[model samples]
Target: MPGRLQHKAALITGAGSGIGLESSLLFASEGANVLLIDVNVQAAEKVQKLIAERYPNVKSAAIKADVSKESDIKAAVDKAVELFGRLDVMFNNAGIMHPEDDNALNTEERIWDLTMNINLKGVWWGCKYAILAMRNNPTDASKGLHTGGSIINTASFVAIMGAATPQLAYTASKGAVLAMTRELAMVHAREGIRLNSICPGPLKTPLLMDFLNTTEKRERRMVHLPMGRFGEAIEIAQGALFLASDESSYITGTDFAVDGGLSSCYVTATGEPTLPPPSSLA
Candidate 1:
C-alpha cells in the first residue's frame, strides 16, 4: 500500500456508505489505518470487514456512534486511538435533513431542532473530541508529519449558495459548518491541527435519496442543478481523500464543493439565463 497517509489513523462518521464509506476505503487503500463509525452498527461492521478483506493487513475498526451525543463521539475517538495508536484524521460526515424539510418560516420547531442538533452540533462534538485526541499524539513537525492531524467536516453546496428548493434547516446547518471550520482551523492552526470542509452539491447517496424518495421533491431538486445530474458518492469521497491526506497540507478553513459546479455556476448573472458565473463590474 502507498504511504499517502502511512501510519495515520482516521475516524469517519457515517462510514456505512456514500462519501464516508468511500473515504474510509480509500484512506485504507492509501496506507492509513481507518476507524469507521456510524449510528448503524451493522453498516460499520460490514465496512470494517470489507477493508480487512481487501487490504489484507490494513488496520481498521468500526464503532457505532450517534455523533450527536458527546459520549458517543468520545467513545469513537477513544476506540480509534486505542486500536491504531493515535488519531490523525477525523471526518465529521454523519448528518440528516428534516423529513418534512419545510421553508424557514413554516418549518416545524421539532424538525428544526432535530436537523440542527444532528447536522451542526453533531459536527461540533466530533471536532471537539477529535482535536483533543489528535493533540495527544505529540508533535512530530520534524518529520513533516501530520502529528497534529486534520479534520474534514461535511457541508453542502447550499452552504455557499442557497437554492430555490428550501430545506432551510439543512442549509443553515451547513452554513454553520463552514463557519466552524474556519474558527477551528484558526484555533488549532499553530498546533498544526488543520480543519477544512467539503461542500457537496446534489449527491446520489442514501442520505439524499432518503430525503428525496418522493418523486415530486426529487425532480424539483434536480431541476436546480445545472448539470441536470446527480453527483456520485465516490467523487465526493475522492474530494475528501484530498482533504484528509497530506496532499492538502496547507489547505484549511476551506470548503471543497463537489457539486458539479453548482455553487459556482450562475444562470442570470451573465443574463442569457440558465447557469453561468455571477459577474460584477467591480
Candidate 2:
C-alpha cells in the first residue's frame, strides 16, 4: 500500500507555525518528504522535531528562509533538492500583515511595498524556481510520476471579498496571489505544473490573535463569520493537502476557499437555514 503523496518531495515556506506547520506535518503523514522553510529558525526546528517524533517513517527537513528574499528562497529550494533528490511540490505560505492600518487612500508606500514583496513576489519566486527544479526531476515510471508537480499558495478570502476589517495592504497582496495563481497556472500548465491559491478565512492562529486581542475587535470580527467561530490551522492544512496531492490533477488557476463558508456568505443570507421559495404572489 502507498500513501497519497508517496515518494513525493515538498518544500513549504512558513512551515514554522500555524497553517504552514500543520500542512508540513499533514503532508508527511500522507508520505511526502517535507522541507520546512521559515524565517524563524527556532520555530522551524521545533516543527521539524515534532514531525520526527510523530512520523518516524517519513523524511523531513527544516531550513530558515526569508521568503521575501530571493537568495534565501533559492538556498532553501536548493537545499531541498540536494537532500531529497527531487522537488515535487512548493507550498508558498509565508506572508505578513501590514505593520500599519493603511487603506488605499492613506496606505504608506513602504508598507505597501513590504506587503507586496513578501506576499506576491515571494510566490512568484517560489513558482519560478520550483518549476525549474521539478522539470529536471527524473520520471518515475512506477508511480506514474512522469509529470512535474504542483504549487500551493497561501492567499486570503479578502482577495475575493473586500475586507470586513481595515488591512488594505493584505487585501492587495492577496489579490495579486489570485492573479499570480491564474497566470502561473496558464504559463506552466503545459509543463504539467499546477498552481493554485488557498484562500483561508479567519483562523484561530497566533497571527490573528496577535492582531485582534481586544474583546471588542474579536467580537466584531466574529459577528461577520457565519460559522460564528474561527477556523483551525489543521482545517486549512487539509485544503492544502488536496491541492498538493494528485487529487487536484485537474485543478489549477483556482482559489480554493477554506474559510468555513465565510467567502461565499452574504450579510442577508445569514440566519437562514434554507432559502425561501420563489414568490408567486410578487
Instruction: Please provide, for model 1 over 1-282, each residue's C-alpha lDDT reduced to its tens digit, 9 standing for 90 to 100.
Output: 356877678899999877787888888887889989888889888888988988877798888889889999998899988898889899999988766877978889888889898899999999999989888885556645556888999999988988667789899999999999999999899987999999888887777888787788787766666666677777787788888788898998888888876776664122232534222111
Worst 10 residues of 1 by lDDT: 273-282
Best-performing candidate as measured by TM-score: 2
Per-residue error (Å), model 1, residue 198? 0.4
Clashing pairs in 1: 266-275, 266-276, 267-275
**Over the full model, what C-alpha lDDT does candidate 1 score relative to the true structure?**
0.83
Which segments of candidate 2 are over 4 A away from where they belong?
268-282
Cα distance off (Å), candidate 1, residue 10: 0.4
Question: Which 10-residue window of candidate 2 scores lowest in summed lDDT?
Answer: 273-282
**Reference-based lDDT, each prediction:** 0.83, 0.85
Cα TM-score per model:
0.90, 0.92
